[model samples]
Target chain A: MQLSAGARREGSPWTGVWAVFLKEVADHLSSTRMRILEVLILLSAVGAVYAGARTLQQTVSEDPFLLLQVFTAAQDPLPSFVAFLSFFLPLAAIALGFDAINSEYNRNTLSRVLAQPIYRDALLWGKFLAGLATLALILLALFLLVVGLSLIFLGVPPNTEEVARALLFLLATLAYAGVWLGIALLFSVLFRSAATSALAAIAVWLFFALFWGIIAQLLAQAVSPYDPFRPESELRQAEALVAFSRVSPNTLYAEAIQVLLNPAVRSLGPVLITQLQGALLGSPLPLGQSLLLAWPQLTGLIALTLLLFALTYVLFQRREVRA
Target chain B: MVIETQGLSKRYGKVVAVEDLNLRIEAGEVYGLLGPNGSGKTTTILMMLGLTEPSGGTVRVLGLDPVREPLSLKKQVGYLPDSVGFYSEMTAWENLAYIARLNGLPRAEAEARIARVLERMGLAEVAHRPVSAFSRGMRQRLGLAEVLLKEPKVVILDEPTLGLDPEAAQAFLQMIQGLKAEGITVLLSSHLLHQVQAICDRVGLFHKGRLVLEGRVEELAQRVLGGAYRIRLGASPLEGLQARLQALPEVSRVSLEDGEVRLEATQDVRPLVARTVLEAGAALHSLALEKPSLDEVYARYFQEVRHAA
Candidate 1:
């Protein structure tokens, strides 16, 4: 049973990638950290949905898109499900990926795994894809739970257009999560200590999610300050702020989700009365128009994700596995 | 040749890790790459595996260029890196199964191979246990199991017994012998002279990024130190016997240490030495030919290289 011919299987070059993907999937699913993160996110999602449901009961009759409101509804005491996800999904992505590369290096398994009949591209790709797959699964489950809870509360099925918009929003969220996962993987490849990579990933997330908006606003202010006497300066100031905010993946994701989930939102930027002169006053945009509005933001998020992965792949390939 | 390298070199900036290495290993032969730490043994192995690209020259494993088609060569070759690591969270069976699946083995064949490899490595009983609980020896054994599971045509082991105890090291050497018996060409690198001497059919003594000496063990000894003999005497004073043996035309040099006279000779002079010793009334307890141990040859070779440099 020599392996000379058994190994040169020409058909499936991705066997190693698939094998690594399955192994990583199992590791992530069975890990205590994953379980804890899952519980944390699940509890937070349920808490937010319950609060949203309580607040939606009073306005269910007035709101035609009651099901869509379940995602964005927030009472004085609780945040919305989308808000919770925007804050917590990054944690899940980072948690799943912070040690993806460094742990293998620390354990001395990277060399052995590379010694097998697999390319480095496959190994790294498998790990990244597996992390994304896990993120997808968790997001899918949370979305289903949110929908299930919202259905019981509203007692009304969502329209086909609403469902399509929500599904697009879900996909946008996955792309958002993928961006963070790629960043975490890049840090993992950069740092030798898993703790360092984890901390770095969390720090980046905190900066983008919490501090980046304020910093971007300040920088925009410095770049284009408002002169109250000159009303045109206000437009320039707002444009500067919007341009700076787009640098953060958080802003891009939030804007895309807002457009997808709320068809009433026509533009992410400030709009003038002249632009809305011929439009219906209170009608929502069609699903296609909503997607078109969010396309740029979605493309930005996807490009960020790919850029991170490309950097990681280059670093991993150039690195000496044993030194 | 199962393995070949032509003027292979690796340089990191200005520092040369391996320089102009020309090596060849025949099929079914056990070749040892012996060197001290930082002597380029690991670098050479990495170059051969195409894990590290050479700055210049070429390498072929099993008639395939490793750099052009590393995956192809890797398919027919197995490597056990120094301090071989597996996923600690997974069981031994799980780790091996993962590797099997990576090699494109079907599920049933993978399971069967895993069982056979684990049984052969004496880890079948603990196959279900997590690898974190395994001892150093057990991990080394597991590393061997990984390398052999595929039955590769060529096996490369980098410091296979670095941390093993005496018994484990012996067991590892025996397993390397077993690989040769199975018609597997093995290229193992080690800094330990005795370990390489015991298992290697031919050895290349690497020094300062260059192979300074290479040949069979006895042939290397003869080339470096010449034909020699050691005769132990029981007499209180061996002055007369030493004089008589040194006076013989066949003897070139003589030295005494711990009541034993070491003789450097151009021919078989044991019989002449024994006759002289008996004639001079010196008690002759044992007579044996002396071959320079691999360490002595290595030291001498390196010293010569240093002086030349």
Candidate 2:
């Protein structure tokens, strides 16, 4: 019931979380980095969508609704949107996160800020939240532009199913960003230099996005001596390789988004083999089923990011502020 | 005492940066930690600030455990590290406001406090300018301004004047005295002995992580200089003066260093010598007194470290 005057000064009920959050945001937001990121993402999203609209205008009709009708008539709009966004959103997410944590530590400013009466968890959480918030803000602006322009030109409110599909796409995109942000933060924590951190993060991103699929295919082909083109056998072999390829976050997100956005898809095909024709044999899986199948892979990617971040926190705490 | 330590030592693997040291600093006292490079003065200060851990000692600041209670302890204490730099891209105002907010000053209060400190420290002219443009001295001033914005109970500076111009250093010393007027406990470390001599109420000379000597600067000097006294007798026969001084039994040895009588007095023979000089009819052109300077006292200790090495 009694406290000394001295003890009163030792612990503030404020964990100093918000202060660190605002400061971390301020560190990047004030500089040209934030502006550069915003400009690059907005321009690319707007430009790509505008380019798609232009291409549709030339091929189908000048009327945007006519273009939408043609796309929906050919195949479900969900799959088409999924195909379009899978490539764009990952780029945006990677751009937003790639250096969030590493740059601060590289600049020798992290320790100075942490030395203030803030918990390490707050600092880590604050940085993560700030990066996520910035990404969300950028995404929101892009969403408004894309949806707004589409609505104005098409002159039709998106149907319930289409809206639901769009929402799923949004969720998957955000999750994909989470995966990148985690890896970036992890790399940031693991590496000492901003450039090195960026290089390592980009290398991991590229490996997952482009190279892993090819590597898994080659590995699958080398292991399968039978005519991998035989329908059922080819299907089994393709699924095994697909499972292996899904281990990389990029491939999993890309494929999952494709499935979620394409309402028409029944399956991803009988796992492709040898000639790559067998890969297209299986019917495309439905959006829901694809997501269910990819849940473990998605979670594993996110967990890996968190694990890297936790390791970084430990290392950061162990570091001596010699400078 | 505002700050006290008991045998504080810090080891970085094989390197003993600081070793068994005892220090006491009182409130409103300008305590100077004097040492050359790598003498562990900075290491000691960092330990006191709870920034570094002592390998085998305890440090208490403002009656709080610095290590276990750093946040609470730091809130009441301000530290200006040697070569402390701010966010170069931020204006001085922004940098100060950032640190103030970190210290839990609300936005409005932080702005007001930052403005007042900047004005008081004469940093207002360039307050809005990015810190990257600030000169070394201006940056130092801004650093101190940031600390003062918190209104800390104790201020600890490491080499605060090391990179300042002579004029700036003079002004800075005056500023420190003003801090004393406000009852702020100031602990500053310096390699320059004269700087400590001018501003410090008490000085501690550290070498190899240990405090070799500490006292009110004048007292330490007096203790060393008290061993010898000069007796000057002008016209009269030296026999009476010499016999009287020697027979009094306080003088241990009498010799002339440079044609001036030097007495190795067993005790302070000031009164006896004064009376002897007057009665002996010696014209006291000047009873020139000599005392060991803080530098001289430190030199002897430094020699010990050298010899031991």
Candidate 3:
């Protein structure tokens, strides 16, 4: 009688999201790829931090922000902690997300999973949230490790401003990771083969990280040729270059980190000589001013992440599951 | 009716995958969708499960519209897709547990039901082993166990016994019969006719996106073959036997093959043919009646369609 009347209660679209999220997190934690990436990041962090502390102790022992210097200071033959992260974080995020959806197709499990009493929204959201949580866990542990190393090397705890700035830097890093995760997820939905999606995600990363800066420089020069007679032309050229480079997420993340970890960074754009005439030189800005300077780049990264994820959602919902 | 589709049609661009399929299946009946590959059997199944949207018409499973209420419809329908896959790294129990959680089953009840289904599927001994180590037959049974975990009212299987050996295919069909015994409606699709013919209470023959014929297997055989029985006779002297067999009132047609006479008739004509052979002064060596087989029916139906086209 109930079947004839069709009075079955409808379930929510998010009914099974938590279960999917937990299972994905467990899989990521136990996977060999995550283990390899964790070791790679940890080794680079320890090496960079040790080198940075040695250089900072010799050069800036009396600085007020000695704790922050440990993150920015770099010795010869090695880059700073920020540089190492900018290079490795994208790879880590890509590893977590490149095969997220296509692997389900490859294994022929997509239809079986979708046959349950849940919507496709739950599956996609669950996988994305799980990736972000895994990235957050790794980044948080790395942050604590760096701070503890700073305490041992500098022989002083960080001030409130320094801790706040460092936390902002951590948030920016996570957002940067999210951008790459979105790209990987997008490619996973667009391509049915896992290998093709993985390669596509890596290709996007490579374009932004290695080639985008040079391409921007060339394009800006072509658009706004420099003229010696008019110095304003040089400024216009420089502004064009910055605008073009900002389209790349790598550029946005790098600028945000520079302003958050180094308090002396007061402006992200080209500044005139008259603007700095009355300002004290080499003095650190307050935490609020530093955050204001990095706000646009920070939001840009988050927006890009959201845009890619939306596109991926649309493509995934339209995909045929028979493959 | 437990499953009904009215004028259901699906089109991808200009290609019509399924067209104007009007199907109705009653509760607890084992209905077979019989066709060769690319005949739209799988496409129809996908529409019924709400995995693919039909370009026209409607589908109702257990009185719930699949497109409008997929969540509730899917909850009561168990689907075993062709070549069903699993998380090979996880144990069979772990995989089924994930499905249980998705179904919103409580932890204790999920565990108890999982154990029961695994045991009934003969997978209890290997429940803790990773699915990568399972053979093809074992994996299919595991897929069936996963389907059973939901306690669904209707089970739709797409090519359930596709690649199994003869013994395993027989065992699998037995399990399908078991589902029918429990008063569950089953809809299975397969290109292999004879395998499904043994179990289906009623079958629909599909051709080029259309249900060309639908009825009970015996009825289909009568309609396609033009007769339900074929009688074969062997005698010492086959000269006048063919003429005598053809002259009988009940026999429709008679042909001589391999020194024996074959008769196609509407009903049992073995006794009448034997009497005719004896009356002709020929020694009766062999006389046997053959039931019409699904293979013959399917082949003959397609031949007629080709001729008509």
TM for every model, in the order presented, reads 0.94, 0.77, 0.96
Which tens-of-lDDT digit does each residue in A204-291 have in candidate 2? 7678767888998887777663474575766667777876776776776766555655543444545234555544444444446756
Extract clashing residue pairs from model 3.
Answer: none
Report the Cα lDDT for residue A43, model 3: 89
Interface RMSD of each: 4.3, 3.7, 3.1
The DockQ of each candidate is 0.52, 0.33, 0.64
**Ranking of predictions according to DockQ:** 3, 1, 2
Off by over 4 Å in 2: A1-14, A54-115, A187-192, A209-211, A214-240, A265-291, B54-56, B222-291, B305-309
Clashes of each: 0, 13, 0
The residue-by-residue lDDT of candidate 2 on B1-309, one tens digit each, is 899999888888999888888888988999999988899988888787666667887899999887678887878888887766777888999888778777888888888898899998999899999889989889888878977988998998888888888898988888888899999999999998876578899898877777778888767755654443434333244556666666667776565454456565646666777787778786444344454467766775556568989
**Among all candidates shown, the one with the greatest TM-score:** 3
Candidates 1 and 3 compared by TM-score, better number: 3
Q: Rate the local accuracy (lDDT) of all candidates.
A: 0.87, 0.70, 0.91
* Candidate number that wins on lDDT, 1 or 3: 3
The DockQ for candidate 1, computed on C-alphas, is 0.52
